[model samples]
Structure formats: structure tokens, C-alpha cells
Target: MNNNSQSLTYTQALEHLRAQALSKQSEEEVPLISALGRIVSSDQVAHRNVPVADNSAMDGYAINAEAQSASGQRFPVVGQTFAGHPFDRRLTEGQAIRIFTGAPIPEGCRFVAPQEDCEAEDGFVTVTRAFDEDSNIRRCGEDVRAGDTLVSRGTLLKPQHIGALAADGLATVPVRTPLRVGLLSTGDELVRPGNLLESGQIYDSNTFLLFGLLSSLPVNVTDLGILPDERDVVRERLTALQGTFDVIITSGGAGKGDADIVGQVVGELGNIEFWELAIKPGRPFMFGSINGCNFIGLPGNPVAAVVSFLSFARPFLLARAGAPFTEAEPVLLPAGFAIAGRRPGRREFLRAKRRFDGAGGEFVEKYRHDGSAQISSLTFADGLVVLEETLTDVTKGDPVPFIPFSQVGL
Candidate 1:
């Protein structure tokens, strides 16, 4: 691996990654049920009003308010309107229609009186209390109007967005095709699970970690499995995948060790840049392109690989998948524990979880261990406590920046 380039700070590395040009995936029309997690290809506009007409917001009696229809006034029940069923004729003066929620109000009706406020007997209803005009009535286009954009282009569809689209009468939507990614893990000392481990060998967990992380995004991943630390084999296999996938990701062979051949092979096959980031856990990473396919190399340590993926690779994939790239906002929270002393250089992400104090306040507490090899720390953590490069120590009750796993797609 080349080591001539200067190490970049965490912020600088992120900016560099964001500046790179990306080729978005092609667009496809998919049903609403299949569009979740997919990036919208175009703005989805509502074809009609949300309710389509003025409707009852509650189960009540629809009435036309007049001088005679006051408190204690009696009116005969004219008809009943259920959901998807409207009264056949317009309501007449001094008469009430039993209306259910979501039922369209009759043309001559001006307001709806709550059933609790009216007494109904022998086909006649009496208003026990006076109500305002247009009360309990949901006006047309109150929630959403025709020509309104239900969802904008490049927005990632979530469950709430799906509900809104369905409410606006959208059965199908245009979304970007899934980004094709070729995932590979390289290291002679790594072996797959369910297999006997030889001396100096450990089970390969980075591939499955990357797989689970990528599954949450809109991408189609092809696991290329593990590769031994052989320069010739690595070069030949990577060369064969060039131009076939939108992106190729590899873990383990990204450092400067003699056994790390992924960076060296990539440099020989195509252009590759080795970026030594000033970040704890994942310092060595490679980013570039092989032929037309993009490449991202992460550290071998399970924790480092996860941090690198969340910090760098995830945003790159999202941009390439046609979604607007935006960093997850860090929340300012109090530290429940204290760090007496620490190095003041590289930015660090500590595994931690939020705790409530019962007095209506929350704070973060770091895990007992900070080693990059301890993958179990992440399992017990709800978020990461971010320590800036200049932060030397943390005192209890001090405000620190935190990034929750949910925000970064755990």
C-alpha cells in the first residue's frame, strides 16, 4: 500500500468523499409495497385532495346551521352516511344526518354536531349544546391538496412516506434501481464460521457485518466470500469484477502490512488512493475506482470496519444510489461518566448507550472496553459517543456530541 499521502482528519476525509462524482443508478417503476428504502426518482404529486371532498372528522350528526337550529333545537334524522357511502340527496334545513368518520358531508350541511352533545330518540335528534359552524368537519384539502408533492425526488421512502403516498392514491412509484455491490473479505488468517479454526486463525466476521449493514440500504450485494492474502489472486479476482458492479468493497487487506495486498493489487489494476485518516479504530482505508467500478476498502478489525462503513462507505453508496447525501446530525448530550485522561490527536468514536436518570434527564455511558477487536461492545451500545480530535478529557455532566445507531442505519 502506498503511504506517501498525508493523513486526513475525519472532517476532511468526509468532505473529500462527498466531493467525488457519482453515477446514479437507473430508474424503475415499482409498486408502493416494494418501494420502501428505495430512493424516489421523481417528485410524487397528489392527483386529488386527501379526503377528495369535505368529510366528517368524527362520528357525529351533520347539520346545516341556521337561526332556528340553536341549543335545545330538535331535528328529525334524515339519513345516515357511512365511509365510502354518501347521502343520496342534499340535507334539508332543520334536519340532521348521522355521519361516521371519513364520510363525506352532504352539500347543504355546514357543520357536524358530536353525538355525545346531541340526544337521539324515535328518529329525532335534539341538540343539547350549541357548537360552532363547520365544527367536526374536515375541509377539503385540509391535510393534502391536489398538485401537492407527496414526496420529493431523491427522498428515501420510509413507512410514513409510503403511507402518505398510498393516502394520495399512488399505487406505483418511480424509484432508482438497486445499486449493485460486490463484497469481498481478504486475509489469510480469517476463516468462515462453522469451520474449524487453525492456529493463528479467527472466524471472518467483517463480511457478515458488512452484509447486515448493507442490507438496510437500497443495494443488491453479491458476497464474493473470503480471499487469501495473495497478490496475484487478489488482482485477478478484482480485475474480473471491474465494470460488472457499481461498487466493490473489501475488508482486511487495506492496511500497510506486508500481508495487506488489496491496496497494492488495486493500485496495479486501476487507480487507488490510500487515505490514512486521523480517526481511532479505522485509520487505514482505500478509495478509488477500478475501470468504471468504485472501490472502498475498510479495516479488518470488526469494530473498525463498522465505523469505517458508517462514516465513509455508507454515504458514498447512498449518493451513488441517487439519494441526496446528508450527514446524520450529532445530538448534544451530557456524559454520565468521566474520562480522566486521553490522547488529544485522532478523533474517536466510543461505544456507549444512553441512560435515563429517573429525574427526567438522559446521559451517555461508555463501554468498559475500547479495543477495536472487541465487537461485542457494539452489540451492547445504542450509539457512539464522539470525541473530537482536540478533546483531551471528558468530565461528568459535560456536554458531548453523540450519534445514535438509528440515525446511521444500524
Candidate 2:
């Protein structure tokens, strides 16, 4: 794989990344109760039709359609049928079956008159209103037919989906196994939280940010902690992680610096497919692998690391886990603020907060500060505003594409 990304547009880079989704997918069978949020391995087809039989939709009198009636008609009530019980005997013209909601309509019964529209006497029912054709009947296979596709492959199971599958009498479902992912933060000047910071050092918040995002994904994440900028040490750790992880993500040590050894070590150990992206706030993005295990190296700047992860790494990991592609599109939002400067050469993404105004109009406001190192900007915003490369300026009320943190499971 080529490490250099020369003249590669953002769309082209994304396409290349998507093409790397896992060819060898893994899946497991689990009870549907525990399958929420898991991706389906294949289409879940219905084994049996929903509402297996033609049943009553309301508590009523199941009567024959041939019965003569205008406003008044009387018939003897022979038996009753509850939800879980059914009348075994057949109903002729002079007899009506007392049926409750969801009770199977006995043979020869064609319509149901609501219990409220009938007068009941000793073992008999007098009809005050007649049922129309097909009224109060939940026909067999009305909701779902046998062999119909219930849910397609790569679907992230939800409550409604589970309900539908359960109604189809499915007890177990096949879902993709979680991908094994590892995170490594590099930089000698970085320290984990709760430790006292010395001169020229910052807390290792990148690990937590990545961990939080990864926790929400359908992947198993291993925190490798912070490593020094030494080439030997970084190489040793990368070697140790190769066999255990499907993809290892590292932050820092990808730029032109004396301490930047991650990219070089990755090149020596495995391959660097691409090392740079044509985007602002995260240009020093690196995607490569070591010993057949993938690795994505992000910039040391906190915000840049986050943006790169969401824009590039998020989709890559989800696709590897066999997730659906239709859910990855960013939502369109109305731009609330104007662009500050002339059009940038590379694509730009701004952290923004989205909400509606008094008239229920939706808009997104961006943080004025565009520093890659600023962590406050991330917390202050709920989503990101994507500006196209061809776009120089954004006027108020223009449609701006926005990616919500919720979509990435942040």
C-alpha cells in the first residue's frame, strides 16, 4: 500500500478507506434479547406468517355474511372465543360466536359486529349495526408473510426491529462479532489524568476521547495507554499489539518532527497506505498497518485527533464490523453563521451546536475559535459542519451538511 496521499481529494480518500472494510466477516448467534445494537449477519426471514390465522380485531359477535339484517337481527350465541382460545364448532346462519380481540375466527364466519353495537339477552345476541366486509378482521399474513425478509444484513438492531422479529417467532439471531480494536497515545510530554503535570506537559485526554467513542461502537477496544516518542519503544509496542488487535489506533507522532517515529516505524514494520489527508484541523492523518493488523495514526492536537477519528476512522471501523452504509450520511442543516475567511484550499469542518429558533426553524452555530488543540470546542458543540472544498464562503441560511456526534456513537 502507498503511504503518500498526493493530490487525493477528500471523497477519494474516503472511498479508499471504505474499500478496506473487512472481507472476512465474523458473526455469532445470540438470543434476540441481547441482540440490541448488534449488526445482523444476514437477512432475517420470517419463518411463519404474523397473525397465523384470521382473527378478530375487536371484541364482537362473529356472524355469517349471509345472515339477513337491516337494523335488527337476532341469533343464538352458541359459544365464546377468547384471545388464546378458539371456538371449535362451526357457525351456521342462525348462530353467532362471542369473540374477543385476537381470537381466531371460527370456520364459516365472515364478519364481526362490535359488542357495543349489539344487545345481548339469554344466550342470544341482537344486532343493532351490521359489520362491513372484512371489518374487524386481522387477516392471516396481513402483517408479515412467511419467507418475507424481516431485516436485511448489516442492520444495527433496534427496539422496533426486535419487536418485529419477535412477532415472527424468532428466538435467536445471527449478529456480527465485535471487532478487536486497540488505542495507543504517543508523546513524552503527555501524562494521564490524576497525575501531576510537570513543565511543558498536558494531560492525556485523547485516550479518553477515543475510548468514549470506541465504547459506543460495536467493537471491543483495548487501551494500550501512552507510549514515549522513542522509536525503539514504539516499535516494541506495535509488535506486541499486531497479533491481538484487528486495528490499532495511535494519536501523535505522525508529523515532521524529531519525535515523530510512529509513521516511520509503521512503514518499517508493515505498510502505510496513506499518511496525509486534504483537510483542515487534521492534515497529519495516517492510515497503515503492522503485520496484517491495521493502524490509524492521528495528530497530537486533541481536536484534530477527534475530527480525524470521526471523519475517517469511524466509518472504517463500522464498515469492518459489517454495518449498514445508509446510516452514515451526514444530515443537512441550515447554516446559522457566516464563514470568517476566504475559501480554504482543503476541506474544513467546524464544531457546531444545532437547535431550532422561535419559529421551529433549525440551524447550526459554529465555534468561532478553530484551534485544533482546543478541547473546549469539542464539548461546546454537539456536531460538526462540513464545508465543501469548492465552497469559499457560507452565507446565513445556506444548507450546510452536519454530522451529529450521536451518529458516530459519541
Candidate 3:
């Protein structure tokens, strides 16, 4: 935290929180097959080249393209190669080797004539056009060299990364240890998902939303269940979680009131950077540290909790997990409908689903209802049409920044 003492913007807060996370995270060795979504602790250098040798990209005939006749001509098939098998004999002049995809090209072969481009017979093939050198041939070390860096440090390993690592014959990978996160939803009116709800009580959805979001990351989650809106009890429960979790997320009591005691207790015990943000459905947010653990307090409203957690907590957690800090890049989409009378100074994340036009182009149709308490909007929402804080009325066909649910876990 800087000494300026001014309230931070959403971007500034994100930068500050990320700056606090790098070294406190730990590293571990994990099985390669199970490393998806895990952050890489260090750069992974390839032990061996992918393909390991010059190979065929298609089921074709390997021939020395330079040896072909100027007008292109027939060549006798000398030997055959299959995947996991290679023709060891040197390819002779005026001869072609039958090779399957992924089969290592024989010595003296410089090009591959795809089967579709060649007329094949019992033991010979004819080409009407001269085969280009290196065409259809996957060169050795082409995809990855033996000493190339496969995955860099702080990389969030995707499925493609896993495959690349496996190509180097690695059985395990070095990754950061999963962030230990404790999730607790507050409010006495909240009930367990499986339990019967009374007239005044409702089933807890924030926890599920948080869980699903966390499940997509590399984290070990401990659900603290629901906490009643008692100040003392909230403080006691929070104290118990201290020193046990890397981060604690609480969903209620972040406002300014005796009933909203989470922020008060956090401020008393540690610090609260800024609890009130100028963002719709996610204004009452708390971010600070306590007992060596980071804390984030979100608003009690269902949609608010979801939006706040995604917008703020996720970046902090990813930085702590040693993953690269990637801000969600927005896509410009055409508004399917017009919106009016929106207030300024607070960014609005309007719920929207996909709607295709006559030309099959995708556009966004904003949901008519914008209540934070309406949890169903989270389901109907395929993306968020981010209307900026300074702007107001958005007419049809206007360009705006949009983010799909897939970019940030639901």
C-alpha cells in the first residue's frame, strides 16, 4: 500500500493486491497428467525434441524432391513405414518410401507427396506435378527443440501445455502448491443447499458460486459453511481461520452497520483498504490482510457476491497462486437493444446473452431485469456488457466492451 491515502480505483486495487502476492505462494512437484489449471513454478525446458525425428505429416510417399524428373514421373515403392515404425534402408534414386502419418522419414528423403496427390499402384506411384521440397514433411525439432523452453514460470498450464510437456516424456511437472482458501457465507437467513427452507430462509447459492469458481483454479478449498450475522461470532470464526488459510472470503456483513460487522472486525484486527467500490452489483467490497492471510469481503446480494468475487478476488488469488496476471480482454459487440437512464460514476456489468443476427454475427441482448438479488440472471448471463462509469444511454448497434462467462469462471 502506498502513502497517498486516497481511495484506490478498481485497476489500482488490482495492481496493489497482485504486487502483494508473488513470494508468499509456495511451489510443489505434481503429476503432469493432473496439472491442468496449476500454475508453473519455474520454466520447463524440453528434455527432447517433439517428433524426435524427421517424420511424415500425412500418409504419403517420401521421396527426394530434387531427384524427381523435371516433368514429374513414376517412382517404384521400395519400403513401407507405419506410425511407431520407420524404414531404415536409405531411399534409393527413382524410389519412394510409403510412409504413414507420424512415421519417421527415411534417410535421403526430402519431401512427401500426399497420397491424395499421387496415383498409387501395387508397388509404384506417379505424380503429375513435381513435389515441393519439405512439403508434407514434419522436420525434426520443428514443434519443439530439445533445449527449448516448453512452459515458462507463472504460466497457467492449459491442456495444450500438458500435451507439450508430455511430448518431452515428462511424467510430472513442477508447479506452485494450490492456494488454501476458506469460503464462508454469512447471514442467519441462509440455509444449506440440501435442507428445507422456511419462509424467511433461503438456500445458500453464493457458496456454490464461489465453489464452482474456485474449482476451476488450482486450490484446496475448505468450506466454512454459513455464519450467522452476529458480530462476535463472525469475529470469532474469522479469528479461528487466521493462520490456517492463505485467503479467507466472506460474503456478508461488509457494509457500514452494527449488523455489517465483518468490515468493522477486519478493520479492527487488521486493515481494510476500501470497502465501498463504485461498481454496480459489487460496490460493497473489502480487501486487506489479517493474521498473515489475505481477506476479501463481498456483498451479501447473490449477483453482487458473484460479480465482486470475479472482478476482484480472482485476480488476487491468481497472483498468489503464481499464475500470470491476465486482465480479461473485452470483445466489442453490437447491442441488440437500447438502454437508457443509467447513472454515471459507477460501472455497470449488465447481464446479457447471445443473440445472432441474419448474417450469423453474434450480438448481446441486455437482460431487462438488473437486480442483484435476482440469482437467475447469473444463469441467463452468457456474458457481461460492461457499460462504463462515465457513460449513460446506450442505443442499439453501439459498441461496448463485453466479457463472456467462459473467460472468467462462473
Taking all chains together, each candidate's TM-score versus the true structure is 0.95, 0.86, 0.94
Residue 52 CA error for candidate 3 (Å)?
1.5
* Residue 399, candidate 2: C-alpha displacement in angstroms: 1.9
Model 2 vs. true fold: TM:
0.86
Q: 286 in model 2: Cα distance from truth in Å?
A: 0.9
Cand. 3 Cα-lDDT = 0.82
- Candidate 3 matches the true fold with a TM-score of 0.94
Query: Ranking under TM-score, best-scoring first?
Result: 1, 3, 2
Question: Model 3, 391: alpha-carbon shift in Å?
Answer: 0.6
Name the better of 1 and 2 by lDDT: 1
Which window of 10 residues has the lowest lDDT sum in candidate 3? 1-10
Distance from true location, Cα of 230 in model 3, Å: 1.8
In order, candidate lDDTs are 0.88, 0.84, 0.82
**Highest TM-score against the true fold, candidate:** 1
Clashing pairs in 3: none
Report the C-alpha lDDT of model 3 over 1-410, residue by residue, as the tens digit.
Answer: 31123544567666777777664677789999889999999999998877788889999788855734513578888888998887878987667888899998899887888888788888888876765678888888888888999999988899999999998999999898888999988888999977998989988888888889999887899999998878788789888778999888989876766677777778777866655677887877777878778888889898998888788788778888887666777899988878788778778788899889899988898888999999889888898888877887988998888999899876
The best candidate in terms of lDDT: 1
lDDT of 1 by residue, 135-229 (tens): 88898899999999999998889999999999987889999999999999998888999999999999999989999999988999999999888
- The C-alpha RMSD of each candidate to the native structure, in angstroms, is 1.9, 3.2, 2.3
Q: What is the lDDT of residue 58 in candidate 1?
A: 87
